[model samples]
Target: MEENIRRNKIVGSRRFSNYFWTIFLFIGGFSFLLAGLSTYLKINLLPFANPTQLAFIPQGLVMIFYGTLSLSFSIYILLTLFWDIGSGYNEYNKLENLVKIVRKGFPGKNREILLTYPLNSIKSIGIKISEGLNPKRIVYLCLKDERKIPLTPVQQPNSISILEEEASDLAKFLDLKLENL
Candidate 1:
């Protein structure tokens, strides 16, 4: 039966887009910072642009502000990537009659977020789909307590058919109803 089958899905946050953005931001921020510094120091810091001739009162100052903001944001994203936040696994164990969802969060008291629910508490498996500019296809676990906990990771949306099939399989394994929302 489907119930006897074990499923453990691993989710990761180290995507190509994440890496691309981090590098892009860093380079852009650093270039801006150097240009601003060149104006203040009266020295050519960047090989491509000569910012030393620019007035520091407005032009240089604006560059510095934008650079700082971008740099700070890039650092934040880098930290999240380094920590591998949101990377974890979902384990559905029929022998233990439990569904475990574990994920890594920011460093602190709740760095490791672990959630466990009894198999009986799962009322149904749900699939939510939205098409358009920001398309989203997600699978959720509908519990008896009316909580719709997402079982899928936050990433690029999966195709509708694949998502539906996964939801159906999960529903059958748990012997619960399937709801498409």
Candidate 2:
């Protein structure tokens, strides 16, 4: 599970599978780009290349265009994922009368996005439970601005019980109302 629900906070962290997919995307994009680049440079890198059938100039220009487009797109995805990829935490500091949500992207670069709100503005803990076949459960904080921010890890069908338990506990601990939807 990528989410951690504890007594003092709820955290949603990206999983290894997410990183794996991101890296896989990077690899595929690069492979496509590399193939395009080689073709563009009039350098045949393919194992089974028939020089007689190779169309250099025309094909090279097309490949250059394709390669540039592919690489540019891949670089965009890589940068976004690199800048905004890892962990996020939401916690309540009762003493300070504040609830804070922080999202950190690169491991130690001080790249953080923070959201803070007065504890009093937290209207309630909202629970949304969808059952049968593809059950989905979500817990959110109902704010005074009419915005709902997820407060717990989304639950799979089999984990509904645990989700409800954690959400209820959170409501109790925060001394807030729990609304079921």
Candidate 3:
């Protein structure tokens, strides 16, 4: 058996209208909604105002609430995008019998969840089953014992049967128990 195997990498699509575009779209929709509401009422609520100086307390409160919520959500989206793109790392291979997986740094390496031990760590693997354009289905190689190493692969166009095969193969390779579900 091979002791170490270099990983074959998979790169996500590089599209202009990906995460950045989505965040922009979210901000656009939020602005449109707020502007439409203000236009319908014919009021200038572009900026926040003190409660006592406001004309209508309820209306002002609603505007402030929605504005805060929208801004917070937009910021969250930005952070998520940055984390995904800036700190993202792809699996080197479909399956690799390695002691550890290390993430280097941005544009070169990133953070990694690794599988350090060959045996006596895994508890069970749960495969997601679904249908859609972008379904969230993958095998989570969970460990029941101590946290020796933590590694999970996020597979696309995922199917349970396929993940089952993969998990079974891995289980046998590691001589670990195969609890398919």
> Model 3: clashing residue pairs?
7-92, 8-92, 8-93, 105-109
Q: Give the TM-score of candidate 3.
A: 0.49
Ranking by lDDT: 1, 2, 3
Q: Count the backbone clashes (under 3 Å) in each candidate.
A: 0, 0, 4
Q: Per-residue lDDT of 1-181 in model 1, one digit per residue for the tens?
A: 4556465555666778888888899899999999998999999999988999999989999999989888888898888889998998887878888899999999999999999999999888988998899998989999999999998888999888888888898888778899986
Ten residues in sequence with the least summed lDDT for candidate 3: 85-94
- Per-residue lDDT for 44 in model 3? 53
Off by over 4 Å in 3: 1-3, 6-25, 28-55, 85-98, 101-115, 118-138, 142-157, 172-175
Report the C-alpha displacement of residue 20, candidate 2, in angstroms: 2.1
lDDT string for model 2 (92-180, tens) is 77777777877665556577867888889999998888777877788888898889987655323437677788788888877899898
Select the stronger candidate by lDDT from 1 and 3: 1
lDDT of each: 0.87, 0.64, 0.48
lDDT (10s digit) by residue, model 3, range 72-161: 766665554554532323232325433344432223343443335433455654454556776755555556663323233343453566
For this target, which candidate reaches the highest TM-score against the unseen true structure?
1
Best by lDDT: 1
User: Where's the lowest-lDDT run of ten residues in candidate 1?
Assistant: 1-10
Error of 1 at 133 (Å): 2.6
